[model samples]
Target: MSAIIDFTTAGQNFQAYRAEPTGVVRGAVLVIHEIWGLTGHIKDVADRFAAAGYLAVAPDLMGLAGLDATLLAELGADRNDPVKGAAAQPRIREATAPLRSPESAARIRDGVKEVFNHLEATAEGAGRTAVVGYCFGGTYSFALAVDEPRLAGAVPFYGHANFTAKELAGINCPILAFYGEDDTALTDGLPALIVSMQAAGVDFKYTVFSGAGHAFFNDGNTQTYRAEPARIAWTETLEFLEKHVQ
Candidate 1:
């Protein structure tokens, strides 16, 4: 079962979804949402993790503003069609801008802390904890890894790549990153980033799924969905978490 909780961060109340196994949990997972916010897909992902015997929590980063699952899905849909994709960029920017703000950053930090608080407060959640994110959530997952030293692992899928060698050096856990070979914009700087992480002694694993462009894991996007690659990525993610968090 799942429920929502109000967490105070940066003086704002951020809503977060929590899911756990029927009985005791093996560990805890913080499931970050996509650019569209905490939609059904994100919730479903959390449920999947819960079913796998982990306590899963998905925080609504865009909760300050109101957005429904359908709208989030539409916003997250393929933007390859210049007309549709280009138009969606501004909307995405608007939706995501708050997260980058100073106030929003503090809120996100506190919000994530609240998740850990919830986990540490529970018997199942106290064992170990990890994080996994998609798209914007993927980027945030990296940030969470840097900010929270207690995390066991992080898996970021097709998210933004923005980390300096110095910042990467501070990460205390392993990271498994998934990217799309065809995503030129996001993948362009990945090689350098990986090199820097390696130089900084950060244990990082990266995979670029061939022929899969951005947002391949998003089942709502029929046009860009690569079922095989997504399935493989999911399998790898589960394995990575089990290996590290367990």
Candidate 2:
């Protein structure tokens, strides 16, 4: 039902977890991962999308963070340990520092576009396509739209915005962003971002789950997962996708 496949972007090889839908494909989606590369959680997200009747692919964008393939895999695997996962947080952040740099962002942008190409060329894609991501992936989902206006929609869950106003203005697709009220580190800047998105006349809508915090939808991370909010978020996401991409 799902498998890992390799694709090249920026002259570097990377692997992605791809899932095909059970019935007629309504659309294709590019699922981006959190800070932890192409971890199991992200693969699960792709599979969930597939279950909803869409071809989904989650790319290992950690490659743009300068992590070697082997080490990236090890780090992704280590995220399963309750202790090691906690201890690995700092290093994970360090490794992802490169993602904020222009060069890395450009590479990641090019890489995701190539993934879209692969999906359309081989995955029996629909005319409409969307991008959805969590945390780190969510940030990129927003950023991707800044440059890739071909997307049908963009959904970013609990990700901080880092794109410029000029870039945001370039996005033509509607954005349905999610956040948790308690995620200070991520939500603190939301007010300013809302102003910018409005000023740019971008079609952006955001919802902040009252009791949920960062990574609330991440069922694998018990410390952060909130079932009720996650379920609500999932339902909302599905409705959004159906309206925009299906």
- Supply candidate 1's per-residue lDDT for 133: 92
Q: Which stretches of candidate 2 lie over 4 Å from their true place?
A: 68-89
Error of 2 at 164 (Å): 2.4
The most accurate candidate by TM-score is 2
* lDDT score, candidate 2, position 211: 89
lDDT of 1 by residue, 85-186 (tens): 878888767655566766665566567777766776776666488889998788878888888778889899987757677777889989999998998888
lDDT for each candidate structure: 0.80, 0.84
Model 2 weakest 10-residue run by lDDT: 118-127
Query: Per-candidate TM vs. native?
Result: 0.88, 0.90
Clash pairs for candidate 2 = none
lDDT of 2 by residue, 91-164 (tens): 76666567768888788878888887776675455457889999888988887788777788989998777778
